[model samples]
Target: MELSEISKSEIEQEIQQSFEGLVEASKALDATRYFEFIDAERFVGLNADGTNWNSIVGLRELVEPGFNAVEKVESLIFTNVRISVIDLNTAILVNEYEQKILLKGGTHYKEAGGGTQVWSKASGKWLLVSISASSKP
Candidate 1:
């Protein structure tokens, strides 16, 4: 899919939904659905440094570790969601989120800020291409 072919509103909605899906997939440990939103052909995930997972099969390595971590948690929440469409087929999304992890008991991690996710259109659908997160100031 090309940028000119997609509607601005559609891009906005897809971007928002994608982040929501991230939160849902994380909390539920739904690796399959999470991978569906990723653009495997050109995926760049940056948590610490530059990392590339340019194939769906390669992404499994990234997804599994996250799913495993969240699986041990009891609940997760994503709040203060804000999304912006950069063009017809690209957007950025941010949110303040928290996760309640239950291991021996329960621990909470709260942040007043969120992350930036870059999305693109592919195969007539929107898929996330990059993600950069930051801690609250």
Candidate 2:
């Protein structure tokens, strides 16, 4: 269905569910599952520190290393999520969340902050197009 035909609540709910699936994939360190939710052909991610991934391959490279380095991870917690439709086929989602990571040597760290993501409709599916995010150490 077109974005114009989709209600705001429906979009919000889809975003929430997609976000939850992402968290689950990350917590499981499942690369295959994680990439399934993204728009591989038109994806970009910018870190808070000015780092950027310009393509799906770049995103995968960045994510895999971290997941491989970590021994375990807790599911991310998203809160205060907000979504704004940008146009007939695009929307933006912002939310605050916390992440905990346990490294191979038993080192644990936690971060809290939020991220903004751009979601685009492609072939009748909502796919993540871009993201800008940061969290405190």
Candidate of highest lDDT: 2
Q: How far out, in Å, is residue 114 in model 1?
A: 2.2
Give the whole-model CA lDDT for all candidates, comma-separated. 0.67, 0.81
Candidate 2 — worst ten consecutive residues by lDDT sum? 1-10
lDDT string for model 2 (17-132, tens) is 88778778888999888888899989999977778888888788778888889898854677678888766567898989887788899999888988898988874777889989
Q: What's the C-alpha lDDT at position 9 in model 2?
A: 66
Show where candidate 2 strays beyond 4 Å.
1-6
Clashing residue pairs found in predicted model 2: none
Candidate 1 C-alpha lDDT tens digits along 1-120: 445445766667767776777777776788877878888778776552345444555557766875665426565666777777777666777666665564433444433446677778
Candidate 1 backbone collisions, by pair:
none
lDDT of 2 at 17: 81
Show where candidate 1 strays beyond 4 Å.
Answer: 1-7, 48-62, 70-72, 104-113
